[model samples]
Target: MSRVVLRRCIVRGRIQPARTSDVRAPGPRATAPNSRDGATPRHSASHDNRSRTEVPMVSSSVGGVKSPRFFYGWVIIACVWVANFVTVSINPLVFAFFLDSMSVDLDVKRSTLVWGITIRMISGGLFAPYLGRIVDRHGTRWPGAVAGLVVGLVLIGFAFTSNIWIMFGLFFISGLTGFSIFGGNMLTMVPPASWFVAKRGRALSIATSGQLFGTATFAIAAALLIEAFGWRWAWAIFGIVAIVGVVPPYALLMRRRPEDMGLLPDGATSLPVVEVTSAVASPTPTAPVASATHREEPDFTVAEAWRTPVLWANLAATTLLMVAISPFLLFRNHYWTTLGFSPTLIAIGVALDPFSFAIANIAMGFFAERVPIRFTGVIGGVWRGFGMLPLTLGMTWPGSVVLHNVVWGIGSGTTSVFQTMMIPDYFGRTNQGAIRGSITPIMVTVSALGAPLGGYLLDAGVSYIAFFWGIFLAVTVASASFFFQKPPKHAPAATDPPTRMPTST
Candidate 1:
């Protein structure tokens, strides 16, 4: 003979009733679900009558797993990596690969065809502010998905268009969406910044380094595709990849901020709320008191940040870098072709660039926190100047080309990492997206002129030496400017929030 009894059972912060025998003591961690499919067994008399306490069952999600064991932020990094990897293949890198073929097929001069790319660059610059504002206002998931679609469709459209005017229009639309910065670029950088403070440099570097991987893999793939199929088919294939490859990851894994995951930045347990008050003193005032308290720094408005010196300095440095690098991006393949390298060899050399970029990117991320970002820019700038000058050496030796890619890749790597880290380090993360957005147009506008300017010079019969030498001089001056850059003083003073573990919710 047995009597039934209802006992209190607490599971996943919810209290219910069960037979006293079915309950088990709470262990170090919740017990695994009893069912083979990893579901919690319903509390019932028939299932278990011998146990006297309730066993805490681990929570299961859609995939039949408990909560993620690793930091969710790294998951964000991985998703962004894939997004950049697929999206970039349709942009100018691959376009550069297809330039000569497209011009010949369309019966257009090389200089005239270059305008399509120029249009895209200018459109990206013009639209950046608006898109950046959208990112700051909205979350990244939808914009990234939509942009992926736009870029994919545009690439497919490019395959069918032979008219120069239509090419310009297609490129313009793609620039508005295909360029990562205007589309989902901010999503990748901003989310990571929101999730980390002390380790932000490393996190940002790791995420942005995805560009290197995309460049390495996609450049080789694009060259190979163009070799096997016609240029039009190459564009079509890249388009399909962009549409299929980019959107799913963001839809599933992308999180806008750490709080969404019930976590704090850098795996913090609690967010700090700091209070700053002005104390009147005759000689000097003491720093704000932030003792044993969670405090947030004062967020600067976009207008306020614009009034600072640091913003302008960053704008100038980045814009100059764009001017220096733009020509190479547009003409690197053509430059190699003229140097007597086969398309396959050129592809191999270009693929090697990312390996160099990856090394510098990771190294910079690891050390960025330890060093002044301005110095990082200086090092990158000096390296770029020398790296660019070598392409003018006219060495047909394969080693010279490889050497050029390695030096330039390593040098250019730090430039991007510094640009990203500088914004948050100088200004707090509160308005990071907006500040970066405002600075973007200035850089892109300068870069937009770079390719056309190079084309014009080439049209006038100027040698690659002339173009490379001019860029080298410009880069040297830009590198020297980093030494004069100081953190913004005009904006509201903000201190780093104290680190503390979050309280268990």
Candidate 2:
């Protein structure tokens, strides 16, 4: 009978047994060369055999099969793409179409209606930290699925609600579920970030670009539905779409981390090996190996990351961007309408915006892989700032509407990629959910004021032209802050022991 020899090896950063057959029967223990003494006695056969038979490590692939050519990470990205499309389309994107109709039907001030968005933001912001911890402890699957259900139901509830307070309650629920988990970039962004490290920027770009396409698709669809059926029916239909698109894919396909699946990030096929010493064998230390294409990132705890200035800078810039962009998105259609642009022209502008956004997104994906994220953010902000200049001309220049959308779309697309990548890139993915969640409250507190503030300003006779100029200023400041956001140096705590790879001699 062949003798089985078991040695411990590190595979893809996890400890597992490497078994090999030896023809020789058990005999005197062999002596291995030791660095200090030149020879060391091996453990007895009983010790070796007992350790070998205790537990069998599960193989990542069955029957020694190679990993598939297609990476499962891309499948995860696809699910995120679908989730982004449905979640965003049902809320802020499509909600713009319903604003006027809902305001008129419910007999509420436009600002009162817009307060729904503010409530959603505030509620989401409050829930984010707790949700982040949950995501860290658990995974995105159940949370995402449940959030999708709540979002879908919330949209459907909008159909039956006439009381503004009830609408506010629904908005609160939607914010807590949809805004925090699915639509607000947490669940959608975190999955791809967790899945791919080297290809993170590109992956996030592809994942978030779904919002642009969803915008293009749903804008026209919303207009058509509102024209044919009414705003109430349109809300009901989008509810159905959100449910159908978001739930199954997230529940079925989502996973926590690549390590959990015995896989490496970015679909890397080769397993890194690290040697560990045991009592039975002489010390044969080996450094942890990583794939050529993969760069191992430093893991920082949330508490540690908070000590760095980069996180605060990014937080400031993100908050400013939200303040500028949120109102612009919420008021785009309304602003154009007030300028005497026809409904059809406004609809065309809304639909065409995503095309430019898609082009910029694809371009940014390429650049993000090669360039500094700070540079990309700076450029996007400047481009977006200039884009607002078109709106200053207003109805006198009929083409200004489309020009603004196109130019701003490109800028927004570029910034979107940068925003998704910045935190994870600097902080690493170990505590990503908690870290991102921790900052959401600050961002939401400031940005949540945009919609209602815009409505109030406009209602108080503040010129939309002046409002646009103010947004340009905010964009300028936000973009400038990115220059200060270099990656933070990680300092490992003294008490924390370094992870050691398990090995058998």
Q: Report the number of the highest-TM-score candidate.
A: 2
> For candidate 1, lDDT tens digit of each residue in 1-505?
2222322221222122324444344432222331111212122112122322222222333222224456687887787777777877755565678778888899987778878767887787777777777766776778878877888999899899978898789888987863554322575677777767657778888887777888888888887888789888988998898888767877777777765666555654322221112222223212211111212222456887788776787688667767766666778778778878887777777877777877897788877766667777888887777677557666777677778888888887876667777766666666777877777767776777777888888889888877777778888888888867765443223342223333322
lDDT of 2: 0.72
- Per-model root-mean-square deviation over C-alphas: 14.5, 9.9
What's the lDDT for residue 192 in model 2? 90
- lDDT of model 2 at residue 367? 82
Worst 10 residues of 2 by lDDT: 33-42
Q: Which stretches of candidate 2 lie over 4 Å from their true place?
A: 1-66, 180-184, 273-292, 501-505
The Cα error of candidate 2 at residue 227, in Å, is 1.3
Off by over 4 Å in 1: 1-69, 181-184, 271-298, 490-505
